[model samples]
Target chain A: MKVLVPVKRVIDYNVKVRVKADGSGVDLANVKMSMNPFDEIAVEEAIRLKEKGVADEVVAVSIGVKQSQETLRTALAMGADRAILVIAADDVHQDIEPLAVAKILKAVIDEEAPGLVIAGKQAIDNDMNATGQMLSALLGWSQATFASEVNVDGDSAVVTREVDGGLQTIKVKMPAIITADLRLNEPRYASLPNIMKAKKKPLDEKTAADYGVDVSPRLSVVKTTEPAERAAGIKVGSVDELVAKLKAEVL
Target chain B: MAVLLLAEVMGDDLSVDSTAKALTAAAQLGDVTVLVAGGNAAAAAAEAAKLTGASAVIAVSDASLANGLAEPLAALVVSMAGDFEHIVAPSTATGKNVMPRVAALLDVMVISDVMTIVDGDTFERPIYAGNAIQTVKSADAKKVMTIRTAGFDAAGEGGSAAVSDGAAADNPGLSEWVEDKVEESDRPDLTSAKIVVSGGRGVGSEENFAIIEKLADKLGAAVGASRAAVDSGYAPNDWQVGQTGKVVAPELYIAVGISGAIQHLAGMKDSKIIVAINKDEEAPIFQVADYGLVADLFDAVPELEGKLG
Candidate 1:
């Protein structure tokens, strides 16, 4: 069975993002960009499924501007069989919401008919955590989210989810959706040889218009502002001083 | 707009603390009707009826819903979607797993982990690991949201809401519960704890984490760990406190040897009073700390424990 993994391009995890001076949105100019950390785990999981002989092919897809092709290429180098880029205009890509992204993925699913769909639980950028669930609903398929462990059998997959109280395992039929969580697995880096080979891999590019998906924003961002900063306080000279200060001020 | 608040319950007992916080969030929108979906939910429904600001409690009991599977719970919420203009629940794992599906089936966008209700249509939420706050206005006719319980106080008791039976929808049977392994603990929950003592990579080894435990026990605080410590196997995955893990806002948070990466800060920077102890005086954790002590955790932790005693 073929597996489809949706990746996203966002600000690098380590980079501290700055809100635009105009309060319109985050400033992304000249900053480092990379595939979302969670999506990298999704790609890693799909590749492992293929290595385990449970999947025939792993396809990585991304929705954004032309730069997104770079993210798809990284996935290809990692282990995806091929890549698909659903290119959008700069403005459209900048403001594309999870619902729109889900719609675009739905169109791709209809065309590819992959047996399973794996995606990141949430993008670190918007942190919406909605796309995978929304896509499953649109496709009328079952979903297991925040999966820490996934085992695929004949026509069903048992997924162990990381929940609030504890771990909860659920079994879903094939042709379902699964979202990757942090503890799923440690992602492997692409070797130099694999990176060179990825250059020759077939990369099919399409536009949102090709799939007839309305890449429109439903939510309007009124403003973006920095969070309240906590001022650094005085340092205590020693344990006795610290204990005394705590007693007088806090305790 | 009438709001439907999903009650978080464990077995037959209601997680009244979290449900009350969710109710507080829902009350901001308009009248709230609580939905208790689980097996043997009568007791939980009775508790939900006592939550202030709710007009009524709807009880949905079934074997399929006993485990709070996403498919069945989402279906139940969708079936009742037409009765209210907004659907809200605490941003717990259950809410995060189920509410998005409900919103999608209803063909609307879900505003998740809402920190503030700017108006009926607009909300404030943290993005970029709480480094930035974004104000968003939704255009959907029906709004679906999960409230970050840390942002609101719990609604008081002494309410007299009515309890009624809710019709059970057919279980999609798309998923089944196998089993669960819960880490039973006698300590206060990390999220609700007034004080939290967290260790980091500098703790050296798993065995050394005992210092952290002893400190927490002395202060009746919850034990937390930075991702680095959890990755090193010094702590359990549940003890991880960061953007990818649990978001906590305790009255006092003590960091031992934690360097305070942005992801780690995202989780605990909301803490009321932060105290950092690290040999490295330049550690980023010191920037957000209300008090800083430059000392090795191995020495300082033991000294602090003795002093507290």
Candidate 2:
């Protein structure tokens, strides 16, 4: 079965994000960009499925301006067979919401018709858990989100969802959408040989308009402002005073 | 413009805080409707109706929904979507699971964990965990969202409304409900607790976490831990609080032995009053702490307990 894994390029998780001084958005000029933390898990899971012979081919896809190609390359390095860069990866000005991205992805779904699709539960930057479900809806496919474990049988796959209290397992047919949770698996580091191999691997680039998707911003940004800054607090001298103060304040 | 608030019920009872918080968020839109999904949700639906400004309560009672499974609940919301323009829910795991499915089915945009409802079409959500705040506007005809429970006040009780029954949703893709391995502790729920006492690698060993538990039990607080502690096997994964873990905003957050890494801060910095107790005064957690006590937690914790005694 072919597996399609969607990856995203976002500000590195370790880097301290600074809002633009002009208050337009985040300052991404010189900031280091990396594959989204959760997307790494998605790619890693897809690669493991191929390694274990659960999937025949693993294709990685990314929707962003030109810089996103680098992330797709990272996915290839990790173990994806090839990559698809939707829209110029380098277009710094191109910003599309999850719904629009899903629209573009639906076109890829129609073209490739992969049996399984894996995505991160949510993106760290937008934190919107929409694309995967939207893709499932657009394609009318069964979806198992926040998947911690997955075992594929002949034509059906059993998935374990990470819920609030514990875990819930569900069985779904092929041609399904499965999202990766944090505990799904530990992502492996790409070796030097794999990185070199990824460079030679195929990367197909396409425009959002090619799929009849309008990458227009529907939501208006009337104004951007920071949250209220927390006030300065008191410093306690001793445990006794701390206990008394905490009791007086919180208890 | 009517807003639909999906209320998650715990057993036969309505999650009062979650219901109230969702209602408060729905109030930002024009009219409000609370849809309670569970078994015997009559009491919960009635209570939901008593909330000061709620417009109506629609109870979808089913033995299957009692577990709060995502697919069936999503189907229920989808079946009832035609009446409302905006759909809202608490940013709990269940809400997070169901909202995206509903939004996807409706071919609309979903804004998760919104801290402030700016207008009918716009909202403010925390980005990079809770460090940077991003305000987004959904241009879709139907808007779906998850409200941060800590961001809004509960809708006041005593308003009058009738509770109506809803049709059972047909979900062909739902997962089965098995046994839940809940951490049975007398402590309160971490996200909703007013006081939270968390530990980190500085707690040293798994046994050392007993100090945090003792403190939490004494104060009726929830016990939380840093990823380091959870990774070190000092605590359970559910207790982990960081950018990748649970996001919490207790009234009083006490960090013991935690150095306050940016990831860890992203989870609890929204806390109202923070107290940091660590040997290293330069710990990043002290930067955000309302009260900083420079001392070895090994000694400070026991002393504080004695003082409480």
Candidate 3:
């Protein structure tokens, strides 16, 4: 069985994002970039499945700008057997919409015929948690999202999902889509030897045109702005003073 | 443009505040018809009928929908997609789970976690985990969205919209519903609570979380936790209060031992009055806090809990 993990390149989780001065989008010039944190979890899970003998191959794919090859290399270093990079855009500033990304992924899946696709629940950049579910709809496959625990049985997978008030466990048939949540697993760092080996790994590059999919943006960004700032209030020295201040403020 | 609002129903009860907030967003576009679908949604449809501005309530009851397997629910929404120009749902776990699949099947882009309806075709939503706001115009004829309930006010009562039976959705049978392990609590729900008390990794361990809970019980506030706390096993997953966990904007929010990472700030920064009690004076949580107190949570939480009584 093969496990396909779809990763994304986004602003590093540690970096503070800044809106462009022109109100166009986030400023990306000289910004530190890395694979999305959630996608890393997905890659880790896929590699772990291979280690457990449940999967024969782990293929990591990223659909983004040309610069996303670095993210693919990182996934390869982390134990992915091979990688596919769909250069949907040349300009690094352009953000590909999730629907188009899902379509491109669907095209890739058709060719690969992987038994499972493990994807991040949402990208930290756009915060659009849609791709995995959208792919499931396009493929007419079962989906268990925000998965915390996953155990693959004979022809089905039992997954525990982190939900609103509690955890929900569900069983989806094979060839399902599973989206990783925060607590799925702690991802491991790529060793130096693996990093060197990843340089030799095959990374097949393709274009959105190659897949015959229109990677056009359906949503036009009218503007981008920083969130309203919150003012820091005076600090109280004692517990009694804190309570008193809170009382006066709320009342 | 007609709007279909999907309301999640558990047993026989619908979350009025959550549903009403989504209705307020739907009312911005056009007439809204509420779709109450879940375990015992037939009875929940009656409650949906009371939310103001709803044109009608459609109830879809089925045991398969009990766990909100996205495939079947998305199918139901797709079947009804022909009647409305816009299909919207509250940004709950179920809403986020199901809406995009509906959008894909309908061949449209889904706008998730929309904070504002700029116009019929445009919306303002948080990106970069609420650090940056982006205004987007959807080009699709049929718009599919999940409303951020924290952005809009709850629609008032005094409505008696007609309730009607809707055909149950065909189970795709791609997924099987397993038992849910719900953390049964008598306290007000974390999202709807007027006051929220959250702890972080600084609180130390699961045993130490009692002080946070005691403070919450004293003030009748809901208990929440930063991702650090939830990840450390100090708190449960549902108690997480962050960009990925739950977006809450209560009247008053108290951060106990929470250092306020950017993700944690995104979830509660919309809250009206913020109070932070942390030993680290330079903690980012204090920067957004309306009242910042530098103190040990172990000492402050118990004292504050005692004073509230």
Candidate 4:
């Protein structure tokens, strides 16, 4: 079965995000961006399925500006067979909500018709964790989220989901949506040859309007300001003294 | 304005903590309706009825929801979404998974990990691993969301309401629950545990974690580990407490052999009492620690465990 993996470009996890001085939103004019960490897990999981021969073909898709082509190339280096870029993600008024992205993804999925869809649990930037479920709902497909492990058995796959207390294993059929959890597998760095080959692989570009989706955001950002900084407090010498100080100040 | 809480049921019983928290959040929008999903969830329905602010309890027991897994749960929520303006669940893993799907199905934007419900459409959530808080406002007609459990107090226990089968919807396509292989631990759950004793690479090896465990057992605490420990394969991912991992707000948090990386502190700094034990007195963890003890974890943990025991 063909596997489809979705990726997004976001601020590198190590880089601290700064709010725009204008209070419009985060200052993203020149911030460093990379493939979202969770999407790395998605790419890794899809690659693993192909490596294990569970998936016949793997296609990577990204919904964003032309810069997202870099993200799709990164997915290619991770071993996807081809890539699709919804280039109109650069539209001046596109909503930041995952559902708007999902609307475009629904169009892409209809064309590719992959049996399995894999994506990161959530992008670190928004931390919304909504897209995969949104895509599943739009396609009327089943979703197994926060998956730690996935084992395919013919038409059915056994997925181990990471939960609050522990793990829950679930069986899902083909044509399912699954979001990768952190424990799924460590993603591999693209080999030099694969990186070079990624340039040669096919990259298709489409517009959000092609899918009849309004890219305008529903929720407007009235203001985005930095959270207040916490004050550094005194460190007590001993446990007894610490308790006494805390009791006086807080209790 | 009316609110509906999709109460997460543990087995056939009510997760008192989740129900109470969901009710507390639902009170922000309007009248509260607690939804219980599972077979023979009568006990859970009864417990939900006691939620102080909840107007009613809508118990929807079905074999499809027996496992409390997301796929079927989302479908159930979708079938009932038209009745409420606000739908919320505890920001646990299950809620995180299902709530977003509900939003997606309803074609509305969702606000997640909300710490405080300021109004029907506005809320505050922490970003940058709780270092920076973001206050967001949702314009969606139907608000689908999850509340951070630690951010709000649980609803008081005492309201009378009737319980009955709400609605049984069709299970979504493609997913079904099989079995769960839970890592059974004697200590309390890391998120809910009042006391958490965490270890780091300084703890040395996978075997060295037992010292932290012994201390946790003595104090009836949960055992946590730094991201470095989990990345080094010294512990399971579940043991990780950091920005990318679980955010815990406990009553007492003790860090042993931890260097106190910024991301690590972001996860547990909200604890009421913080203690640090590291050979390096200058570890960043000490910056947030109310109590700092400069001693080797190997030497200090056992002594502390002995005293607590």
Candidate 5:
């Protein structure tokens, strides 16, 4: 069985994002970019599945600009057999939405026919958290989202999902979709040797038009503004003073 | 516009507080018709009917919906989509799982975790982990959204809306419900709790988390933890409060020993009153705190507990 892992290049998690002064969007001109943390977990899970012999081949696909090939190369270093980059037009790249990404993935799935697709539950940039479910709906396939644990057994996979209340375990058949959560696994760093070898891995390039996807955003960002800031208050000298302030002001 | 509000139900009863808040959000759009879909949903439907904003309740009881597997639940919602111009649910895990599918099937975009309604088709939501707020306008004929219950007040119980039976669609039979391992806690839920006490990596070990629980118990608050604490195994994942975890806007939030990573602040910065207790006066958490106390939490927490006692 083949496993398809979709990775995204996003602003590094540690960087504090600033909104552009023009209110267009976030300022991402020279920010450090890396594979989304959750997608790294997804790639790790797919690589582990391949290592365990449950998956015969691992294919990493990314939908973004030309720079996204670097993300796919990182995935190859992690152990994906090949990579595919669906290059988006410059205008489309600025406003790519989850629905459009899902449409493109659906087209890719039609061609690859991977038994399972693993994706991050949410991207740190948009935080849409909709691609996997949208792909599942578009394909009429089963979906087990927010998966913290996944154990593939023959044609069925038992997934432990993190829900609002607690943990829920469900069994989903193969040819399904799974979105990786935070606690899924710790991703491995690409060794220098592996990074060098990833350069030789075959990478196929395509475009949004090739998939017959419009790549147009349905939701328009009317405005972007910094959230209201909370001003710092005076520090209390002692526990008694803190309690007094809490009683007098807060509680 | 007619609105369909998905009810979050546990067992035979509704999650009243969450559903009530969802109803309040739905009321902002139009008249609400609550959909209670689950294995034993009659009681939940009755409870939803009591919410002030609901005009009607549709109870759908199906064994397949008992666990809310996404396939069947999405199918059920899509089957009933024609009657409503808008579909809304609380931004819980179930809503997050199912609403996108409904939106996709309807060929519309989902505006997620909506903090405010700007109209029938526009919403304001947090982006970049609450660092920025974006006002989004959707031109889709049908609007699908998930409301953060923390941003809305729960509708009171006084209505006597009529409850009617709703039809269930065919189960895809592609997934099976195994079991749920829920953490049984007597304390209030983290999101709805009026007061929350959170610990961070400075708490040191799992044993030291007891101090957090003790302080929380004293104040009748829910215990929360930063991702560092959860990742370190000092607390469970469910107790995590951050961008990736649960977002809470409680009346009082106390951060103990937390350096206030931006991700952690994204979850509770909306809180009405925030207090920070950390040995490091320069911790970023102090920036958003309403009151700052530069002291060792190990000493401050115990002293605060004793004074409260």
Candidate 6:
């Protein structure tokens, strides 16, 4: 079985994002960028499957602007056999909607025919947890989402999902799509030697037009604004004062 | 425009509060038709019919719908796609898993975690995990969305909508339910709780985490944990409150020993009255807290719990 993992490039999670002053969108000029943390978990899981001898090859694919090449290189360094980059947008600020990205991925899946596809549950930038499920719907395959643990046996994958009430486990057939959650695994940092070898790995490039899928924005941004800041609070001296104040105001 | 709301069903009954919250958002657009799909369809539909702003209920029942799997639920919503102008569900785990597939089958994009209904075609939703809010206008004729339950109030009772039977979509049988090990807790649900008491890494160890729960029990509040605490294995996954976990906006949120990272702040900053109890004077949680107490959690938590008595 071959595992196909899709990664995304997004603003590093540590940086505090700022909204553009003009209410257009987030300020993205010169901000540090990296593979989405959740996507990094997906790539790590795919590589682990290969290391376990449960899969033959791990192919990593990314969809976005040309700068996404760096994200794919990181995945290659982490142990993906090769990488595919689909340049759907030119501007770094333009985020391709999940619908269009899923369509283009469907076109790619038709060509690769990988048995399993793993993707990030959501990107930190848009926080849209839709693409993996959209791809599953378009392909008529099974989907296991928000997965924290994924185990593969003969032809089935048992996935443990983090849900509202508690943990829920499900068994999905092979050739399915799995989306990684935060607790999935801790991804490893690429060693200097592995980073150098990743340069020799093949990195194939394509365009949305190459797959005949139109990547267009479905939702137009009317405005963007910073969330309202909380007002400065006063410090309470002791537990007695804290309880008294809370009871007077809240209870 | 007519709105179709996918009800969140738990076992035999509808999760009334969450479904009602989504109803409030749906009512903003147009008349709502609540779609109740699960094992005990009639029971959930009966509850859905009582929600305010609900004009009708479509009850879809099937054995395969017992466990919340995306394939059959997505197919069920797709089957009814032709009748409604907009399709929405609560942005819960099950809803998030299924709605995007429905939107994809209909060839439209999903506007997730919507915060406000600016107009019929425009909405404000949080992006970058609540750091930035984006208002958007949909170009698609049929809008598919998931309601962020935190953004709206629960609909009142006093509505008598008609309950109609809807056909359950055929199960694709691609996935099967294993068992759900749900933490049986007597406390109120986290999102709907009026008062919440959360612990942080400062609580130190799993055994020491009991003081946070004792305080929650005394106040009849739900128990919560910061990502720091949850990652440290001091609390269950469901107890986590943060950007990647659950978003909560209770009447009062008391943080015990939580330093409050930006991710954790995104979840509870909207709370009406916030209180932070941490030893660190410069903890980020203090900035958003209505009342900040600089003290050791081990000593402070016990003192607070006893004082509440």
Q: lDDT scores for all predictions?
A: 0.90, 0.83, 0.91, 0.81, 0.90, 0.91
Best by lDDT: 6
Per-residue lDDT tens digits for candidate 4, residues A1-251, read 89999898887765666776776666667777889878998988888888888888889988877888999999998899999888765631233578888888888889888989999988877777889988888888878899889888888878999887788999888778999987888889999999999999999888788888886765565565666553565655554564465356433
Mind giving the per-residue lDDT tens digits that candidate 6 earns over A175-225?
Answer: 899999877887899999999999999999999999999988999999999
DockQ numbers for every candidate? 0.70, 0.49, 0.70, 0.52, 0.71, 0.73
Best candidate according to DockQ: 6
Using TM-score as the measure, the top candidate is 1
Candidate 2 residue-wise lDDT at B79:
90
lDDT of 6 at B93: 90
In model 1, the Cα lDDT at residue B190 comes to 86
Docking class of 6: medium
In candidate 2, which residue pairs get closer than 3 Å at backbone N, Cα or C atoms, i.e. clash?
A65-A88, A65-A89, A65-A90, A66-A88, A66-A89, A66-A90, A66-A91, A67-A89, A67-A90
- Candidate 4 per-residue lDDT, tens place, B242-261, comes to 77777788888889989988
**Cα RMSD to native, each candidate?**
1.9, 2.6, 2.3, 2.7, 2.0, 2.2
Clashing pairs in 5: none
The CAPRI class of candidate 2 is: acceptable
Error of 5 at B288 (Å): 0.6
lDDT value, candidate 2, whole model? 0.83
- Model 4 segments more than 4 A misplaced: A88-95, A238-251
Tens digit per residue, CA lDDT, model 1, B1-309? 899999997767899888999899899999999999998789899999998898999999989889888888999999998879889999888899889999988888899999999899999999877878999999989999999888899999989899999877889888888888674777788877899999999998899999999999999899999989998999987788887677788988999989998778888999989999999998999999998999988999999989974
Q: Rank the candidates by DockQ, best first.
A: 6, 5, 3, 1, 4, 2
lDDT of 6 at A57: 97
TM-score of chain A of each: 0.96, 0.94, 0.98, 0.92, 0.96, 0.97
Per-residue lDDT tens digits for candidate 2, residues A118-228, read 999888776777788777777767778888898888777888887765577777777888999888887899999999999999999898878888777655554445556
Q: Please list, in the order the candidates appear, how each scores on TM-score for chain B only.
A: 0.94, 0.93, 0.88, 0.94, 0.92, 0.91
- Clash number for candidate 6: 0
